[model samples]
Target: MSVNIPDKGRIFAKKSSFYPSSCVTEILLALLGIFVFIQLFYYLFVFSKLMRHDPPTAAYAGAPEGVSVLVCAWNELENLRELLPLLNAQEYPLFEIVVLDDRSQDGTEDFLKEHADQWRHVRFIRIDKEFPHITAKKYALTVGMKHARYPLALMTDADCRPIGTDWIASMVGQLGPDKEIVLGFSPYYKEKGLLNWFIRCETFYTAIQYLSLARAGWPYMGVGRNLMYRTRLFFEHKGFYQHKHILGGDDDLFMNQAATRTNTSINLDPESFVYSIPKTTWSDWLRQKRRHLSVGNYYQRGNKLRLGLLSGSHTGTWFVGIATLLWGLFSHDTLLLQILGAVFALRWLVQLIVLGGINSRLDRTVNWLSFIGMDIAFFIYYVGMSGLILSRKKKVLWR
Candidate 1:
């Protein structure tokens, strides 16, 4: 007697009975489902805030207030030379550029001294020594803020250049009567390299998180490169006093503590954007990222939980999704394969639409066609940097 056996196609046709039989495979499938759900939740709920946001093109309606642009520089003479003229030419009615020279052995001091008469709005404060009590960068910022001539303080890095003459006006205009903090976007100058693409993508994603959360009334962090706040707010918070011992977090950690939903506003105007020079080499970028990520441990418990969930789900979605898809392929389970394909397709679709909108708003550095590949690269980045992110030992350098 000969027994009859069903072919692969016939087995696949009976989808109901073709489910994974192995416990491990079933568990992975379940986890993939959960992660996909989380990803969708973030995309449809949290990130949608940014996607739906319509930036205003009109100038601010309220009366313009005097703004003191605060820049902290450490051996950045060359960058300052480029930045000062831009600051001096700001179209705002009343503003001053206060540069904090933090013990720069470079010709920054002489350059500022020589150019004092040339740049009408530029002023320099020299920091001869460091204070053991506070971190170097924070201490420098504190000194600069103390010496600011105006109540409104707009902070940008020495390496940053504003998009246009309206940078100060656009940023200060967002600070309505009630708001104390205004978060602005800063993108890296586009360069012809894979590293530059990743940097821009990473920056856009970071902005999406904090900016969207701010829009959603859970404001957490802001970048120093183009952040604005009242001088009173800084002094009230004691000026990075809580995390003074740590090297980084002049912007994020301070915002983490001081920024309330009602007090913080975001500036999305392209004219307000500040462009910063990116690290050209891999080692330089890695060190910069390490210093930045080291401050994540100091965020509030709720902020940490929210960010951890978003990032954790993002990482899981890629890893678990791939594993399940591979399992389905090896097992020749047509239903499982279809389910995985649908999950991935849904994620990519949502990412394309939402991130595509965001990319258009900022610099269009991320190629929508290659977004999934870039996302997978970020997943690898998260895994690779996990150790540094979770480290408790404080980074000691401020440069």
Candidate 2:
């Protein structure tokens, strides 16, 4: 029982060794809390809009309105061959498919000329030359819209095929008198590769944001693979004249500039979906994404802020969350570790529920169990794409 009085310095050191520095722990805890709050806000408040959405039944009171299906093709001869039959077979009346061939050297002209009589609803316009100032895709789209026969214009890529024959009717049914822009869903065909999974998940997440935000009266963008609007809206906005010099954004940039809460509508009908062929290689996919994201800088200030917060918080949720957990473990603080675990668990639980519902609603290919992995992937993707998105120097070509 030699209570040999230990030095005061030794006692202080022993206590300090039991836990990490208070300042570091407090700062990390505060950051973790904030990031968790932001993550929950998006899942609960923002994404939940899509989760809870109930698409109206496809209906029309009168003769099915005429719709001009715009397909812009450059080197999409095979795709057009596969897609034309489907477009001609759509279970809708008075819909025309206008294919604008943008100086294709790949026999697209020959193929269309050969089968022009077979595809009754399909029509093709060969663009012999390119506009020096305009991007290829935008120029083709502008020409297609100008030649659109119907008042309503439905756009899809040449590489995309509708899931069902009712695609036009389902999408057109959403356009009420007040709605001018109709945003439709487009998913990549299920292929056997990790790249395919990533592409599908990325598309799913993007659809969630744009479709959900559109429903929330903050419509920002739409995918060209499956999108629709009144031809009047395009001409009124000068048909991509604002950003014609920049590649990509033929769909999104136009939507960002034209879509409004009252005029925009979203069609989630599975039949309305158009499935496109995804990029098989990483380089091809990266180039495609670079073009897609190049227009982000031109988004409306409010839209940019909204998307930035959502993406920034998503990135912080992983980075700050992991850091906090590591610190808690290092400090040997059971309470801190337990709190961090609970926060992460809660966030993931919400994510699973919300995103799971979305997957089931849109593309059921991605397993809910893979959400944690995809969340981490998205974190990496956002961080990686931030620079490319910010840089206005990289020239993106739309082929």
Candidate 3:
């Protein structure tokens, strides 16, 4: 059978464009200019708003009675050596600590059993090797949740360290009778090189974007490093029921489906923060980030909107920079381009000035000169990997 094609003017004509090349270029440049302005304004507004209010003061200094702490690990024995002592050292009077071992080959089971007697609330679980899926971390946490005896449940990875003895109390204190989820801040441990600094900066900036959104009405996600929720909420949401098959993002993805504005709370206390060593090498960091981004497609609409706005800002910034350079090359109006460049400088200067205080508090190194290059590298990597993440249809194992 022969298929009839539509008329040229009716179909192909609409796809063809004969606008003057100069006009088309100008239109594109104008669109780029608008995008850059919007990008600058959005972050500027968020930064200014976050600065306008003081970080919330914790209402309590310790986890309430009957709080269960769950730490999940795979081949993370040495991390537990320091981690358990830290937990035992918590100022809180009442809390139970449990560690889930996901078929670890690093003798994590023996290590936990060896130190199991040191703490009053310590417990351990060793998973059998015959488990069905590669999502061991979530499965292990599920096991811990099954054994949890407290009304409140808090989760932190074995590799992470709490900032202070009051960490548990501070995190759980944010919860109230009505609150079901509490999102806490976590930053990278201070490190030695440019790579470490860049990692912390990228992580911190990404976190600020999401956590600030949580502070606003749209609460969609949280980091697992220092996440707490009610035990009832966990069962009510079915505890990663829908996302269990995905190898990563058991934390934020679960929060994406579970948290709401009325039931969620944000804990910004510095003393309550948890710090994990940032991946120091490019390859290690890349693999870790790839695992995290693999679950991005599973986020809800609000999550997508927030991330979409961020991606647009990055694209617009590059478009503006390139367009400005080209305008200087081909246009006769050199003075107008110079004026625009000055305004752009002012905008970035304001940003750096605000970031100065934030960087100081987080205790991450700040090298404005180096960040210019780091930011370019991060933007390119994130944009390139975003396509791979968005198109993924199968469950990917955690790297």
Candidate 4:
């Protein structure tokens, strides 16, 4: 199917028969002008609206619901050993930690058996190899959910640890009365490197977009680390049936299909945050991102278009805006150059305001000087990013 966007006059100009070349030039310039304006409007209107959202602060009434922390692990012997003790030590009144050891060979089953067999609240399940051809991660997640004993099921990766002892409590607090899903922030622990900076900045931006949109009654997705939704909602939605064949959607695609504005809630309590271990190498980070990008093809059409517009206009802001400015300078068009310069400054100012606050909120440092440089470099960055999306051969393993 072809897309037919509604065209308005002056902005969407048509070429003339007699002066076709000149009309074409005018049309291109007008389109560039419209594109830059859209970029400015997006930062000012669409994304910057995130600044208005506040953290979930209502007192959680009554006794908080018991949570079944469902973790799916494959060869996460080290992580499980370190985090399980902390999970059990939560100060919350009622909760259980359930882990699925999916055919792990690195002594994961042995580690699981020692504690799960002895403790009442801690549980573990072993899944042996099967030939029926199923997405291993989704299957493991489903098994954990089926065996969950509490009303709410909280999911976190084996490599993740709660930000604080009250992590479970803070996440549970957001599900108050009618909220079925609680979307929480998950930030990677800061390390010393440029890659770490990029990872942190990306995480902060993603959180701002998802959290802000959720607050605006357009909830879309949540992170698996520190994510909670009712067990009933899981079974009701048939536990990843929507995109079960794909391995990575256990967190996002499920949210894309199941979340609705009224039923979903967000918890921005720093206490509710989950800290994930960032991949130390470029290859590792690429594989992790490929897993995420693979699921984009399956998002709902409207949501996909929303992202396309957001990225496209962002791209246009750099390439088209620069080209327009260069053309004005070459032609000695002072008025055109002046207008473009003002818009460029305005856009940069707004980005600094919005992104600076977001960085602070997520405990990340904001480099005021690097803001423009990074924004410009992202044009080249996205080209490689698009390639990662297309290279679906790299798998997202739970291990």
Top candidate when judged by TM-score against the true structure: 2
Each candidate's TM vs. the true structure? Answer: 0.92, 0.93, 0.86, 0.87
Task: Please list the Cα RMSD from the true structure of every candidate, rounded to 1 decimal place.
Answer: 4.7, 2.9, 8.2, 8.1
- Candidate 3 residues 1-399, lDDT tens each? 999988888665555543343564567567656766765765676644554445555566444467789998888889998899898788776788988887889989888778799788788888875456537777888888989988788888888999889988887778776788888778887778877877777777766676667767677678888899888888898887788777787788888888887888877677778998788788777667767776677899778877777677767667666776676566555665675677567656766765655555554445555545655766676677777566644544442
Q: Write the per-residue lDDT of candidate 4 for residues 1-399, one digit (tens) a residue.
A: 999876666344643333654464476567776777776666677666666657576345667677899888888999988888778877788899888888999999987777675655688889996434558888888888888888999999888988778888888778756789999888888788888878776776678778777777777788988799999999999988877777687888988988998988888677787888888898888877777767778888877877777677778767777777776777676777787788778878988987776666665544666678667766766667887676547445644
Per-residue error (Å), model 4, residue 251:
1.0
lDDT of 2 at 85: 92
lDDT of 2: 0.88
Which TM-score value belongs to model 3? 0.86
Q: lDDT score, residue 236, model 4?
A: 93
Candidate 2, after superposition: displacement of residue 22 in Å?
1.5
Lowest summed lDDT across 10 adjacent residues in model 1 is found at 55-64
RMSD of 1: 4.7
Taken over the whole model, the C-alpha lDDT of each candidate is: 0.87, 0.88, 0.74, 0.78
Error of 2 at 135 (Å): 0.9
lDDT of 1 by residue, 1-399 (tens): 998887978778676455535665789888998888888898889887776687545355556678899899999999998999999999988899999999999999998898867988989899999888888889889998889989999999989999899999888777766789999999888888889988988988999999999988898899999999999999998888899998789999999989998999988888899999999999888888988887888899999988999889989988998888788888877888888888898899989998888788776756787688778888999998997666665444687
Candidate 4 lDDT trough over 10 residues, lowest sum: 9-18
Q: After superposing candidate 1 on the true structure, give the runs of residues whose Cα lies further than 4 Å from its correct spot.
A: 1-22, 55-63, 390-396
Model 2 lDDT tens row, 325-378 = 787788777888888889888988999999998888886857787899888899
